[model samples]
Target: MKADSEFKKVLTLFPVVLFGLAYMVPLTVFSTYGIVAQITKGLLPAAYVVTLLAMLFTAFSYGRMVRAFPYAGSAYTYTQKSLGSYAGFFAGWVLLLDYLFLPMINYLLIGIYLNAEFSAVPVWVWILLAVTLVTFINIRGIKLVANVNFLLILFQVLFVVMFIILSIKALVSDGSVQSLFSITPFFSEDSSLSLVFSGAAILCLSFLGFDAVTTVSEETIDAKKTIPRAIFLVTMIGGGLFILVAYLGQLIYPDYNAFIDPDSAGLEIAAFLGGNVFKSLFLAAYIIGCIASATSSHASVSRLLFAMGRDSVLPKKVFGYISLKYHTPVLSTLIVGIAALAALIFDLETVSSFISFGALSAFSLVHLSVIAHFYIRGRKRSLSETIVYLITPLIGLTLCVWLWTSLSSSSFILGISWIVIGTLYLAYLTKMFKDKPPELTFDADEDIKVSS
Candidate 1:
């Protein structure tokens, strides 16, 4: 019940930070370049400067919420605690899309990357191989998952550190100092500011691993302390690293588009700097990073489904079952696996923006929840907490609205439709399971009645 106790557990910040580095690296490089044309009108550095500031605003709200709740469910947990069940369900549902499809996206990228390494092998084979291995590892349990993540993150962070150092060296030796600020005018003479910011806002989607860690809160030891610390460290350090990489990208290749080919952005950057060896290294790191992202994402979807089943808001028999042997959520992980693979087959550009929309939607609610819980409820959070909770969330919400609007009206309709479907399902299940709430007295030895 105490706020201070949540911040007590020991975490070195490195392991806390390790899980997110995988998701952040590739996401930053690929997603950022997609928006560069709009922001810099082909100039890269100017666009990134704008992006760094926008990311900071959203991250502030995320950091505060993690400290506040420090529970499982990430956005799902926070929204339910503050706003009530229905709102929480929508938050969880939208986020399910983000988590469900991520492995597919990672697989798709990995498949493509591996195709170059072993040209004869099909990408799907590699995808199947990667997912098979990861699922088995995840099935082992959160502790093993964490260990896998710790190692993946270690490799990824080392790669990135080497990258930054190499990039700085290459840029300094090969290019002019003045080029750093050469593309200062981000909002080109001809471009619309609204559109440019929108693109940049869209680019911040890659900087979204902060709250992703929150979804793993249940499996975390001393979650109240560990979760918040993880959130802050990942966002602040990772966000800064992303910006540094982006800027280094600009420094290494003032004309970034030319340096990074449309098909292989990270590869081209590596090629532009140090040729095949460096490029190959970057690709290897990028793939490892994507796997890290998938690992965290896999854990998130499993936990979300587990929570829903516990609430009796989902099919208790289908989603409720945890792997007895591994003590991990079993059915939920299977469903997520199927969904992520399916997402790859029908993969749409709209999915990425929608991912951002869902993430920010939940993020907005979490920030609002902080205000509702700690401030409006007259709980223990200080004025500083109150201000951060209120102001930061509002800023993040407004940013969400801006980016949400930027999506084609079709994405808006799809986004809205998904929530509506989730609501109806939630209501149906709520009514069906109305009287079936899990009882404290219900013995594990007794009949485990599961409502369909």
Candidate 2:
């Protein structure tokens, strides 16, 4: 790759924020609404509140790290630079669970919704079609994916607005204006702090976009400034939207048990609010948005694999190879597509648990990275510096650990299995820790971009 062919610093704050929001897929609040509502017993908003608070602190840590190392690789780079290559390799490995399975989650969602609406078609067929389409588009190039995601994101935002308005209107029609105000969404007799924390653990998937923006640091202008600002903005805006939509949805339909299908509860709510027409529109928009999201995640994990492979962390020939014709990581993209086929076996809730586990693990590592880099290594131990570097990150790390406890036993089993596998691989790669693990380099020939 020529120097001139490298990533251009053309992105500004607004576009970067849009990219982050798009990656987040704001409508995802609906995707997990029913499951979370059931888990929290109608305290979805409170769960989101807990999640938002956790993300805010971690976002602060991410900002500090980006200032120190303004590049791609996100948490992996931060951990490697601050800690050691072995820790960093594990960070990237664990994070790969989040990145690799996210597309699978979207595929699972596509199958769930399309199968719900069109029962004649098998769910595997929809999953296959989605995987093929997303893989094809991603293999083509990133520019086309970017343009498509922009329009998809606009439609998703529009759908969320319409859903909120319709929910409010239904609330008013059902009772008086007072019907719109309810404490039950945040607190009810059945709701407990433990349940809310568990819900928050699942909902952490909704906040993945804030950290995703850090991957674009190398491509953004004034990335140290722009990326941090984008992270905070994305987290706040996305969290607020999730909280509001969940609040309104809960207010409109307090009886979570009434839904025929918990996974497709949002569709039932849409149909109740408007009619079949609105529900159809909701289904279409959501499927389209999931496709866009799947494409973005597919491309992201592919590039991450390319980075690790280029560093000889993975097999250089397979994982690191880029297609000459398309100028993309074709092999890695196909691997991700094949992995996404796991959607056929896994259900939405289980897959979400897996993603949340990976995400929470990475978040914990980032907080530790901040303390390692700024508080311990830099040694800026003034009272203010200690608070900024030590106290804040410690708080973030604590919250992340608390959330981890809330994850299901299945998540812990699967997550630990992944870690054990990574440990063995790291041992072999480094010849039993006698040599440092190969560090991943994010800036390389392959294009690293993400879209919704």
lDDT (Cα, 0-100) at 166 in candidate 2? 85
Model 1 weakest lDDT span, ten residues long = 1-10
lDDT, candidate 2, equals 0.84
List, residue by residue over 114-156, the lDDT tens digit for candidate 2. Answer: 8877999999999999999989988886655666778888899
* Candidate 2 least-lDDT 10 residues: 443-452
Model 1 regions lying over 4 Å from their true place: 1-13, 31-40, 43-58, 174-192, 256-261, 379-386, 431-452
Candidate 2 ranges with C-alpha deviation above 4 Å: 1-5, 174-176, 321-328, 440-452
* Cα RMSD (angstroms) for every candidate in the order listed: 5.7, 3.5
Among all candidates shown, the one with the greatest lDDT: 2
